[model samples]
Target: MAELANCPRCHALFVKGPAIVCNDCVKREEEDFQLVYSFVRKKENRTAAILDIVRETGVEEYKIREFVKSKRLHPAQFPALSYGCERCGAEIREGRLCESCTVSIRSGVQKQGELDDLEARNKKEGLGPVTYYTVNDDNR
Candidate 1:
């Protein structure tokens, strides 16, 4: 069943199903996509960067980035097309984050897992009472 909701772009009420925006916003988005697609498909504009395309076509940078992120624009054909990392503002052609951010996040998770394992081991070993030991200086 479709739920009634307000369109994100124009704040108009519409049935929300597969699309978040209303029909009008969808049509506008389609037009923008066509404009961007047509511009990028031209032989002379094939090598143009996202900024160049935006400047030439008067399209918003975020719109172009969205196209690239959604796979609407082929990164191989448009080598300069890239999006900012979600964690860091680094240029990346694929995925939500750059390689460095990915590694950092993975390392952090590994460290957390190791800490949890250590805590589990300590608990399993019975963390009950504390004991202290003393050595007599005369023994030396």
Candidate 2:
């Protein structure tokens, strides 16, 4: 079932289906993709970076990045094509984050798990919050 919604790109009302944007925007994007694909398919432009492709093809950087993210443009064939990490703005060929950010997040999760285990052990052992008292010389 298609629902009426405004297109994200052109703000035109259209039936929403598998695509997020309206038909007009989709057509425009297809044209842009063709322009970019033609430029990158060239032997001399095979090694061109995203900026170079944008400059030569007159295509938006985000559009090219979107193609790379969607796997329409493969980085294996064009080594210079890549997208930024979701967490950090580091250039990455695949996945949401770069290797460094993934490792850091994994390490943090492991450390949190260890802390939770230790807390559970302390609770099971009947250990509550620690209390400290200072002696009063007058009372002593």
Candidate 3:
């Protein structure tokens, strides 16, 4: 069901549906997409990077990135069209993080798990920090 909300792009009140923007903004975005598409569809421009496409089409970088993310622009067809990894800002065609960052994060998580396991073992074995206790037998 559509809900009433303000459009993010034009600040117009619109019934929010599948699209987050208003109808006017959606039309404008379609125009921008066409411009960007025409520029990149050419054989020579197939190897053009995202910045190059943005410069030629006068479209914003984020919009181009969105196109790539949505698979509206296939990076396989246009070798240079790519968005940044969410972690290290390296250019990537799919997923949030690039290969190296993913590996690094995975390694970090594994190490953390190892540390946690060791700590748990130490705790279970009563091998934690030393404590002193004094004997008091006066009451007895």
User: Cα lDDT of all candidates, in order?
Assistant: 0.89, 0.94, 0.91
Model 3 CA deviation exceeding 4 Å by range: 129-140
Ranking by TM-score: 2, 1, 3
Rank ordering of all candidates by lDDT, starting from the highest: 2, 3, 1
Choose the strongest candidate by TM-score.
Answer: 2
- What residue pairs are clashing in model 1? none
lDDT of model 3 at position 54 = 76
Model 1 agreement with the true structure over 27-52: per-residue lDDT tens digits: 98888889989998988888899889
Write down the TM-score of every candidate: 0.87, 0.89, 0.80
Among all windows of 10 consecutive residues in model 3, the one with the lowest summed lDDT is 126-135
Alpha carbon deviation, residue 64, candidate 1 (Å): 0.7
Q: Write the per-residue lDDT of candidate 3 for residues 16-97, one digit (tens) a residue.
A: 9998899999999999999999898888998998889877889999999999988999988988888889989998999899
lDDT, candidate 2, 39-63, per-residue tens:
9999999999999999998999999
Query: Of models 1 and 3, which has the larger lDDT?
Result: 3
- In terms of lDDT, which candidate is strongest? 2
